[model samples]
Target: MSQLISIPESYESLNLTHINIAHHPPQSPTATPIVILRLNRPDKNNAFTPQMGESLEQAYRLFHLDARVKVIVLTGAGRMFCAGSDLDIGFDDRVERAGDFRDTGGRVALAMHRCSKPTIAALQGSAVGVGMTMTLPAAIRICHEKSKYGFVFTRRGLTIESCASFFLPRLIGMSKAMALITTGGVYPGLSKYFGELFTEVLAEGTAVLPRALEIAREMAENVSPLASYMSRALMWQGPTSPEGAHLLESKVFHHMAGQSDYKEGVNSFLEKRKANFLCDPYEMSPGDYPWWSEVDIRVGPKASKSKL
Candidate 1:
């Protein structure tokens, strides 16, 4: 419906030339909706570039705004997921002051994190440096057992980027995270050192994307968009203290009880039918929705008006 891998007319303003956007089901009027974003430069081994990062940020922002989108699938074209940054055009050449400039990978990761839709990364081949770190924000990662992954920052004389400092340890535990960082070595997707980084590691490289798509389809068909988003958000941004968490949970319960989906959810369960959850969670956000303040984090890159 949207010209296969080409950007949809609705998304033209975003100038997403670096990535391909395709809608699952290929029809506009469908209950089950999923969007796929592919890193489009297979010729270059799907290397990460500033343009790619900007396009990804734009896509994630679009996903956040579109209520019809249920799940997002991120993967690369051809064989490799990503080979880290395009080293030919190094990141150190930026003209902005060190304090003012934000790394592209970090910005892209934040955008992915802020998106309300569930996201899955399909790593069909090896991923290194920025590629691996960027996928850390995804809710799930499906990888090929033979695919290699690395946190190769130390080898490049750099520290971590893409908010990996926050997400990597939380995902794989401190010991594994520290070991990976310290070694800066590439390991198989099924490595015990990664803990739970990859939700499913299939034996075949071709199976990774299919498995990711299956999971995305299942999520899109069954999960309540509002409830799913809230659950993830709360888990990531909840209060530290048990008393504070309890208070926040009570407030959320009170707020959700007033929404239409709450009644629909209850009625559907009582009647033994699929619940039609149509409420837009952002629109129905509670008064203290963002209980915590976001300081200087940039949510999205500026969209370009020019056509790609």
Candidate 2:
């Protein structure tokens, strides 16, 4: 019999106060785990400050390193998911120090995109500007039926963040994307027809967190950690020839096979027991998913009330 190598069961404790970050950790331990990150400043309607952005970056980095965190569920603390930037402080002045301001959205988008694990944005209310752009990179998006989504960039005399230039059109179609971006329009049913933006739209006043956690639990329970990681990477890589994808698959397969978790997974399946995978699949390499193609676009009937 081969010797089993044990992995760490918990993360190293650190002082996060120094960074000015706050969070409510997970409540239970399950094979497949979900980490919920809420925007904690509800008094301000969860408006994001520069420091909050830094803190968020730190939190994401921690999640990236922790082997136990598989899926992530992000939401706001109060009525709003995010109201965009805090008008009191200018995010532009901090742009040079914060990296690409024009591509600021893209940078964060890359972080979410590159994460080995899947992410879900549970939007209950308003998600505007940076808030909306951030959700673009998530693997799944669940929004309430009454939830409102807005581009709101042109109205503020700012450009879109992240690689929204590349992502939005792909999800909503070029014509729709153009109108939304240029007009800074808000939409209620846009996510319904544009499946790329959101997978499910629930009833009004539905609680998004519970549903998100439910999904995270399902994914953690049924999917193979190794296979899930590789599949996510493949999807992120987008559409490629079988031969090309196969080459990438070969490397991931060999790497997974050598891990102790792989052996445990196979053994557990045969024994009709749950696999105890110590590492979270979200920490693995990201998959390649398809980008949108340029096609002729059309507009749906305009609503009586203008989405401003």
TM-scores for every candidate against the unseen true structure = 0.89, 0.73
Q: lDDT for model 1, on a 0 to 1 scale?
A: 0.85
| lDDT tens per residue, model 1, 1-308 | 54333323444234475688776766544323688789989998999999899889878877786777889999999999999999987764365446656889998999999888878999999999999999998999999999899999999999999999999998989999999999999999889889999999999999888889899988876677788888887888999999998988889888888888899888989999887888776576778777889777543455688999
Give the lowest summed-lDDT range of ten residues in model 2: 15-24
Superposed on all Cα atoms, the candidates' RMSDs to the truth, in angstroms, are 6.2, 11.7
Name model 2 segments beyond 4 Å from true.
1-32, 92-104, 172-175, 189-193, 238-243, 254-271, 279-308
Tens-digit lDDT track for model 2 on 224-258? 65566566656655447888777767766776777
Best by the lDDT measure:
1
| TM-score leader | 1
Evaluated at residue 110, the lDDT of candidate 2 is: 68
